[model samples]
Target: MSTEKPRPTFQMDGHDVPFDEGQSILAAALAAGRYVPYLCYHPEFQPHGSCKVCTVKINGRTHASCTTPAHEGDVVESNVDELNDMRKGLVQFLFTEGNHFCPSCEASGNCTLQAVGYDLGMTSAHYSPLFPDRPLDASHPEVLLDFNRCILCELCVRASALVDKKSVFSLAGRGIQKHLVVNAESGKLADTELSVDDKAMSVCPVGVILRKRRGFQVPIGERKYDEHPIREVAVQKQKGE
Candidate 1:
């Protein structure tokens, strides 16, 4: 008799998905070759569940798949039209809330938000543009901060505090006023201990944190998302490709 136990499985969109112990629904699904549209959920960090883009129905009620634990025999619905429409709306809101003029943005092809927007078939913003007049932070000689392009995912904040061991970034205000701020008395990246090699510098899913004078080094069309859709790239990355 074998001593090893069988893996727990869940029904995702009618397909059987086997998950390892302590895996979130999002993590397990990606590992099982299932693609779920998400923005704030990164496999590298603990599940934030801030962005509800991965919202899926479990049994009857909805939950954020990124934070939801996988259980045996749980019926999860993710790839349905209803859920996809809701995800699309969330992406649209993100687009309109920020000045994501994709053509003019440096993170156009490489941006996870833009890739998720495409995966969800977001044809238009649908809502009127907020166009919040946010200031750009160019005080850092090695990095550039474009506040207008930020979706407030807080990847940088978590990365700085956890991985890099430096609390370089943080969130301020609440709700509509909630935004990213550097942990500096002068409120600037240059004043903080942030470096180009820090984990926080590369964790931004958008163009908010970028290296100065390093634009288009790989060329626009040759970027990561440019070669493969984020759906494929994200899952492949999780699979250690």
Candidate 2:
């Protein structure tokens, strides 16, 4: 006779969703074909919960879904007006936090930030731009670092250290002063050992990192998020359906 324990189940919205033993709420939701909008919780990397865009109500209390574990009989609420409105506000804050001039950015149609903004129906940045005068780093002949569009998501940091096996990028400071830093004596990519083919090169979810001499190569309306919205792609990725 088999004596295996059954997988746990939870209530998301009005549906009974089953989850594996050690899966997070976000993981279970995505696995069950539910798309939870997230920024800092990529499946390839460990959950950081930095963006808090995946905030969902679990049993009438707020929790970061990517970090919170799923348990049996737990009630999870996502896609409600309250949570989505907060997501929109956070998206707008990310917009105003940097000089994300989308029209001029090379990552225009392919930017996750831009895609999420469109997904959330963000018409304009509700807050004023910080305009911090961050310098553009073009020290590398094959890459460019435009800090203006950086959302500080730290995808590059994770990819470099974990995927590429290079300790090249890291976050510095706290709160408003927080920013990405290259591990180099000259504080530049040219001085660092980062190559054009590194995983970190293509890991920026925004326009902060770009390959040199490759702008406008694909043109507008032909990008990844051009025809299909992020919601569709995200759902497809989650459910594998």
Question: lDDT tens digits, residues 102-201, model 1?
Answer: 8878888899999998888888999999989999999999999999988888899999999999999999999888888989999988899988999999
Candidate 1 overall lDDT versus native: 0.90
* lDDT winner: 1
Q: How far is 11's C-alpha from truth in model 1 (Å)?
A: 0.6
Per-candidate RMSD, Å: 1.6, 2.3
**Over 4 Å off, model 1:** 1-3
- Could you tell me how far off, in angstroms, the CA of residue 194 lies in candidate 2 after the best superposition? 0.7
Error of 2 at 179 (Å): 0.9
Q: In model 2, what lDDT does residue 140 have?
A: 91
